[model samples]
Target: MFLHLGGSTVISLKGVIGIFDYSLTKTNHVNNYFNNGKKIIKICEDDEFKSFIITNKEIYLSPIAANTLKKRINSQNFTEKVNILQEHPTFK
Candidate 1:
């Protein structure tokens, strides 16, 4: 799923696997946030502080759906988890 936040910026939630099993989960929070028009907000006083709150709120409210968003916001790169299906000859 891809979310376009007003401008050119976009949030992509792809290749997300749920706990217990490597099954893809639907990103519901992203849709809800966008639909509610809470993507961007304007703050007059303590702009920096308010910005932080907005960012944190976005993450706290949505964990599974916001996994990719959190990574991007925190400047962390995404790395796929190793697949269990692949066989390692060294282990055998």
Candidate 2:
């Protein structure tokens, strides 16, 4: 499954480590350290960033809210599970 961060940015869900509220970065030193040297790909055009997505290979700054992104992930999980169940012999 793939998750859309915003704009044209779509990432593989398998590689995603976490999705976090951008505001947390303001107070978290660990987040600050990650931002110091890593290349952050901003998905939105404007400077307003509501969330950040941490993946296996890259970090993304997204304009979409963290809750929205989380919902998307949850929905994907639900759909995938349904598909798997439908493919089972018992479902046939």
Candidate 3:
């Protein structure tokens, strides 16, 4: 599944190692990660910034809030479950 990180940015859920709160994740810490060749992609919505970090060698700064992204993840998980059930013979 692919998660929309706001704007044109979307990432594969399989590669998402972590989803973190930007307030707790310091800028300097992210910069340090960047220096190590970890790619950083920022998705901005207007001027507001509520970034979520996705690290799987690369770090993505999503414009969406952590809580909101969590909700989306949960929703996707639920959808995946439903799809799986539907594909099963017992479900029919």
Task: Write down the TM-score of every candidate.
Answer: 0.18, 0.73, 0.67
For model 1, residues 1-92, the per-residue Cα lDDT tens digits are 44322224344434222211111112344335435544333222222211111232231122222333343434544354412211223323
The segments of candidate 2 whose C-alpha lies over 4 angstroms from its true place after superposition are 78-92
lDDT of each candidate versus the true structure: 0.29, 0.69, 0.62
Top candidate (lDDT): 2
Question: What residue pairs are clashing in model 1?
Answer: none
Query: Judged by TM-score, which candidate is best?
Result: 2
* Candidate 3 lDDT by residue in tens digits, 1-92: 87788888777777776676565444565455557877667677535567656557677766777768777878777344211110223212
Give the range of the ten consecutive residues with the poorest summed lDDT in model 2: 82-91
Look at candidate 1 and tell me the lDDT of residue 18: 20
Count clashing pairs, candidate 1. 0
Worst 10 residues of 1 by lDDT: 17-26
**For candidate 1, what is the TM-score?**
0.18
Cα lDDT tens digits for candidate 2, 18-87: 7777766655554565767666788876568888777777778899888788788787763432111102
